[model samples]
Structure formats: C-alpha cells, structure tokens
Target: MAVIHRAELRPTKLELLAAWLPGRRWYQGHADADVVRVAAYRFDDPAGAVGIETMLVSAGDGPVHQVPLTYRDAPLDGGDDWLIGTVEHSVLGQRWVYDACGDPVYVAALAGVILTGGGQAEEFLEVDGRLEPRETPTLVSGSGSEGADVPGISEILRVIEDDPTLVVTDSVQLAVVRRLDGGNRLPGAALTGTWNGQPNPMPLAYVSTR
Candidate 1:
C-alpha cells in the first residue's frame, strides 16, 4: 500500500508538467497551455523508497497525456536527462522527481505488473497518525495472469518518444501510450485503465518481447 500525505507541494505537479510537456516531441498542446489533472494512479515500490505515480492530464481542451513519475529523496545516478524538476514537500522535505520511463525501479515494477496481471497499489491517507483507506481516482489492471514469469529489467536501454513512448529493456519493450485519444491496438501483455470520464478501459502500456 502507498501512504498519502496531506502536505502541500510547492510548484505543484501540474505546474511542473506544464513547463516540461511542450518539450516532448509527442506533446500536441501549446507551450503555454493550461494543464489540468484528469485522473491518477499509483504503483507501490516493494522497498518503499520511491513513490511511483502515473497521472493523466489534459492541456486545455486537447488530448489527455499519460505521464508516469517517480519521487525520490535524492538524485538518480546519471538520470539528469530525465529529471523533470524538484519540489518541496511539506512533510517529506525536498523531493527529486523524474520521468518514470528512465527510472529502473519503475521499469521493473511496470514489467512485473504487466506480466502478472497486477493492479495499481492500494492507497491509505495518513491523518493524525492513523491510516485511512482512500479511493483511487483511476483504476488500472494488467493483461497477463498471476504466476506469469516477469523478467528482471536492470536498465532502460533507450526511450523513444512519439505518439506512444517506448522504453527498451533487455527482455521486453514497453510501449507507454502518450496521448489518450484512443485507437491503440498493440499486441502483448498490456496495462489498461479507466477514469472518471473514460468509463471504458483504455490501453495505458503494453509489453512486447525483445
């Protein structure tokens, strides 16, 4: 389970994404467009050291984008290229945020989820020293079944950003859907999700053998 804090964030997640999204080749919105959160989900880090969250956001009236992010207390070694920016957390202090495509932890977690038909992490909000179960705004599930073998992904060999972002690993290639405009028909073990407006499940990512 992932714990949620009531603390405030300086230069909120949307604020940071608004500045970074335009730089990506697949981004279809204007540079100064207003980015708004649509829905979000989380994956738990087994070691509980990193916070993994995937957010679905829309830029003005444009297409929704899937942006997976990881939060850490310190900088990721040799990950300067993927660093989105840092934010000050009222409870966690300073946080180093990076695009999840470049984080090895996220890659492994995502692979495991896709291969094992796992779902997003359960969330609990910390309030006055008590943990309260919180309902996730979005729900996601994988296509593979439980007990399926999941390969270990030690590194991200390459990240190609297009309509769908591809992360190349030693064992498999992960295709992360960038724009949530529908009509994604990739074959392989995949992850799909549903949000408020989007009641039907849509493809979020898929894993293909290398």
Candidate 2:
C-alpha cells in the first residue's frame, strides 16, 4: 500500500510554531518570528491509521532547519500539553494532531518492537516542566495498523553526501550517512543540500572524520 499514512497538502502546523520554536532550545532568534510551511512529506506506515508527517517549516531567521515531527490519530493523553496544538483536520475533515507516542496503543506497539529488538521504548517527555527521558509510562498502541518505528533525523541526510548513516541515537535523531565530497564542514547530523552546489555532505562538524 501507500507508504504515507496521511498524504495531502493540508494546512501545516506553521501558525503554531510561530510561537513555539522561539521558545525551544534549538531556535536561533528573531525574538518573535513567523513560520512558513514550505514543503511537507509524510512517511508510509505499515498501518493505515497513524499519521506521521515530516514538515519543512521556514522562518525569516536567515537559514532554515528541517523540523521532522510525528503526529498520530488518537487523542494524546496530554493533548497540547506536550504537543504544539490540537484542532480539527482541514483536509481529513475533522481530527486532531495527536502525538502517537502518547497513545497506549502506540506505546504497546513500540514496546513490542523494542522487546524483540532488545530495547525498550523510552518516552522522552516533559516532566516537572522540563523535557526529560523517562521509561515508557505504559503500553501504547496506534489508531490502526499504521504503527512503525520512527526514523532518525539522519534519514533526511542524503547518503550521496556522507558515509554510512552515523550510528548516533541519543539525540532522538540519526546522523548523516553517505559520503563527503568537498572541503566544507557538515553543520548538523542532517543537511538538505548545498547552496551553490559546493559539496553535498561537506562535514557536519569539522570535515572528514567518517
């Protein structure tokens, strides 16, 4: 079937980020910036229920960053508590952007995967007003069979740029995998492409260490 769970050009979550990103630790500045939805793509889930969307939100803050986020169908236990916002779906008609990981069905599915892979689903949630990594609260599941492992940020990294995807997994994102082809340094673990067609995967940090 289609790999994307929910594929459509609907209203993006840009408006929400206008007030969210600046508050994040990763946000650069602009004090009060606005988010513009550029391009968005959804990943195909083994199931047909859960919603996993990858959005490219751009702010007027000079450079842009690819913010990959995961959305679910079920109502997250915490609602917008941890999520950006919740509202009726524009294209799907009426629904909310639930952070699937919060649902019990999804939790169970993730637990099942980890159980078989010798790992556990750790919910990196905000506790005491601070985002921290904690053990899975309970068993979680998905709305439908649309449950699958979330990809690390590295997947966005063009393999033609760096070496094998970096095994980095502590930051909730995968490192770039592919090959470097120039003298510049790669910025983050993931990069979109070169500005002037310099080198694709220049170096994330210094240059060639992979």
Best by lDDT: 1
Candidate 1 backbone collisions, by pair? none
Give Cα distance to truth, residue 139, candidate 1, Å: 0.9
Error of 2 at 112 (Å): 16
Scored by lDDT, model 2 comes in at: 0.38
Each model's C-alpha lDDT?
0.92, 0.38
Residue 157 of model 1: what lDDT?
92
Cα lDDT of model 2 by residue, 126-189, tens digit? 4454556543222222211224343322211211212223322222322321222333344422
Per-residue lDDT tens digits of candidate 1, residues 1-210? Answer: 999999999989999999999999988888999999999999999999999999999997789999999999999998999999999999999999999998988988998898899999999999999999999769899999999988877778998877688999888899899999886778898999998999999999999778
**Estimated TM-score for each candidate:** 0.98, 0.44
Over 4 Å off in model 2, which ranges? 1-12, 77-81, 91-93, 98-210
